[model samples]
Target: MKQKQMKGVCLLIAGILFLLLFFSFSGIEKTKLLDTDGRNFEKAEVTNVISGNLSNSGSGKQTVELKLLSGDHKGKIIQATSSQSYLFGAKCKKGMKVIAIINESKGELLASVYSVNRGPMVWLMAAVFVAIVVAVGGRKGISSILSLVFTMLCIFFIFLPMIYKGISPILAAVLVVAFTTVVTMCMVDGITKKSVAAMLGTIIGVVFSGAFALIFGQVTSITGYNVSDIENLVYVGEMTDIKIGELLFAGILIASLGAVMDVGMSIASTLNELKEQNPQMMLKELFQSGMNVGRDMMGTMTNTLILAFTGGSINTLVFIFAYNYEYQQVINMYSVGIEIMQGLSSSLGVIMAVPVTSWIAAFLYSKNQK
Candidate 1:
């Protein structure tokens, strides 16, 4: 009725605001470093596989006939050679999609296979995820999807540009996390005591994660410079205003965000429900109840966070063992140190959120009923 109409109007206004702000972030220019000035990448289908020179690795140079599907080259038929390396290109079959890199330099045009066109499959997988989320969660799933999109846009659009402008990476991450947390919680649960508690707890937990990374990294001599890909990033830093340091801590904050927010929201929602169920409960009783619930959740949530970070390093772990590195060597490796830091710091964030969220929810619930 009237209430539903009012809620709809409010949601519409919020959506409009989010879209306007998100699109405006496109005005922030990205630093160009790649020499892509004379290159055009267009989608093309392999209409015919003309020939291949097979090597021992089953990958070698090949000539393919392509029908361009997009860009100014649409409908053009061209013959191109695949990059000889196994990592860059592969033998093609008819009807397979590949990316055609057209170079217009040297007063001539050259076409080659840059890679396979995997864009459709990637988007298809993403679509499946959205479908499953919506099918399982219904309305809450829809709200969660919107919040997820907002968080992504905040990262790639606003947070990235801010850091590129020489802003402190950690500071920019915090700002983005705070903004996303408020918007996410509000979107999920509206402006209520529980959502407020969740927002505060989420922010505190994320900051704690980043802070631990900073302090721990200092003690372990594991700065951002220790990362495996620092050389490439250093080149980017030299070319642009990007802050080369503190990206690790910023990443730690962003990585821990989902787990920390889950813990915070769970505790807040649980405590609110407990308070409503036991209206005459004392403040001490409510706090104890929250602590009890938090303790139960602490183990699994911390494990989840740790496992998530560890999962990203499974290959590194395998390599260490496969190479038969000694205990001393393995322990001292920068990759190992980074993985350990990421896991423990993120777990600590989840751990901290449990108590902080529990206390906040308890305090709010114990207030005099309005």
Candidate 2:
């Protein structure tokens, strides 16, 4: 009971620290080009939306009365004119939330309706997810949620900031992965030998996966510029000293980290349980048991990675198939090749994680017995 209380206290302290760090990093200015002279964006609630006749462009004009929810003009009621295009514009309605841009440069407090405010909806969905996880998973669910929040914090705060500050993208990703793995494993399994073994295995598997992705990407001529919005990223890279070229394998390493950690944790946990059940179980027997468990996990985990990547790029595949492209042509396409690389590299990580985890678990558990 005392141990549990201490663990809870530690988690509470960590959560507070994480929140402070999140807000501090989130507020840091990221853009070097934007020079706004007293211009700000604010959230507003639409009290009334008056519609005008449709224009020749098949769009309507609206006079929206908004109550400011944020910014220096909070609680101020203002009227804003908005043109709503039939095909693309967001039509505001009564009581609907919207984002407003405030321009003070003209010495007039003018609020322009930008778009519908979707932030609340996103937060609502996240709340539902957390409630369900906590309800079903109980204490373990809480641990999982904490780990998830910490992982996101690491990505958003540590990884992104480091990359933006001119650190190597690959090195930043590696550090984030290592940090996430250690925190996640410790949260789930406490400070046990199983957690240590799992952490080691996860780190090894993720590193190998990154190495494979880098080597194969070079061999196949699949540069990181194959994805959408890469040109814009290249432009940003010019402004910032970011090496956009190394982002591909860095992406692969981060994407595969979850599956690798899963495999490692599973193998280590199974070995620990087996050792606890039969204290006299030989090291060889424990190792074989872990292998058996890992083999079963490997098949499904590999398929999961492949299907996940395929699902994300299903539209690209459909387009290629619709064009009746030859297999050679389709495989040679940069987009398709990159997807294949991601799937295969991630699967390799999951596959390698099994044995790496099993061996470590076996050795550690055996030593614990002695």
Task: Give the winner by TM-score.
Answer: 1
1-370: candidate 2 lDDT, tens digit per residue: 4646645665566567556656654655566766778888899898987655657664777778889999888999888866677443357788888888888865678767777788889999999999999999998899899899889978988788777777788998998898788778768766677988999999999998998898888899888887778988898898886788888878999999999999999899999899889999878898899899999999999999999999999999899889899989998989888999999999999888888888888988888565
Per-residue alpha-carbon lDDT of model 1 for 169-270, expressed as tens digits? 999899889888888887788777898899999999998988899999999999998998899999999998888888988999999999899989988998
TM-score of each: 0.92, 0.87
Against the true structure, candidate 2 reaches a TM-score of 0.87
Stretches of model 2 off by over 4 angstroms after superposition: 1-31, 52-63, 81-89, 109-111, 368-370
Worst 10 residues of 2 by lDDT: 81-90
- List pairs with backbone clashes in candidate 1: none
Please identify model 1 stretches exceeding 4 Å from their true place: 1-26, 55-57, 84-86
Error of 1 at 167 (Å): 0.7
CA lDDT of every candidate? 0.85, 0.85
